[model samples]
Target: MEMLIVVAIIAILIAIAIPTFASSLNKARIATDEANIRAGYADVMVNVLLDDNYDAENGNASTAGQTKYYLQKDGSVATTDTNAYKTQGKNDSATTEIAGQKVGAWAKDKKVTYQYDNTKNQAVISFE
Candidate 1:
């Protein structure tokens, strides 16, 4: 029957659309994480400029004299917690690692990772 054929075609169309929609959603989350990393880098630079003796090893920019700066969603300086953006690896290495806790829903247990180079002051974002 024509009705049965039409229903089958509609179902196929929906199946195709579902995957595309999910892919787009995942890409959006990745983009958001990238933006957050860039913002954190900028905040750190600002703190470095403000405090002449800011010590990056202390990891407490808001407390004065610390070189490292943590960023919040509202763009305020965070003194303690860096849960939103987790820093990994060593700054002295060729690549310092940064990670975002909340990844795309489709990524399941995987977290988004970024490799930062202090020499060039650049970050390379990745999902893993």
Candidate 2:
């Protein structure tokens, strides 16, 4: 009887923990996404201040520097022309090379990117 009670208690605890763990994991994902976006935005704006490659009508920035401007990603998956980034809106403009990370795991088939808005002279985030 004592062993059975222990087993039952363990099972109950596991069941309760599973959902709570899942929810916590999701919350962590959201927090990570927010942090990545904020930091990435700052990175892009800093690049703009240091870069001299802006053109009035082109809406572009340089990619030839030591660091490629994919913003948050690094290593191999960084520069691929795959779903890591979505090309739409003014992002498809020939002059602009948008830089940002994939959106949070809560979202699929989407990415967050940064581009310098020449008219406004500010870095803007775009979701695509």
Per-residue lDDT of model 1, residues 1-128, tens digit only:
99999999999999999999987776666556556666665565565446555446653334333233344555444544444454221122223334433222223333333333344343334434
Give residue 15's lDDT in candidate 2 (0 to 100).
100
Candidate 2 segments exceeding 4 Å error: 53-70, 75-109, 118-121
* Model 2: per-residue Cα lDDT at residue 30: 52
The estimated TM-scores of all candidates read 0.54, 0.53
- Point out the worst 10-residue segment of candidate 2 by lDDT: 87-96
Residue pairs of candidate 2 with colliding backbone atoms = none
Tell me the tens digit of each residue's lDDT in model 2 across 13-95. Answer: 99999999977775665555555556666766666655676443555555413333443343112323353533211212233
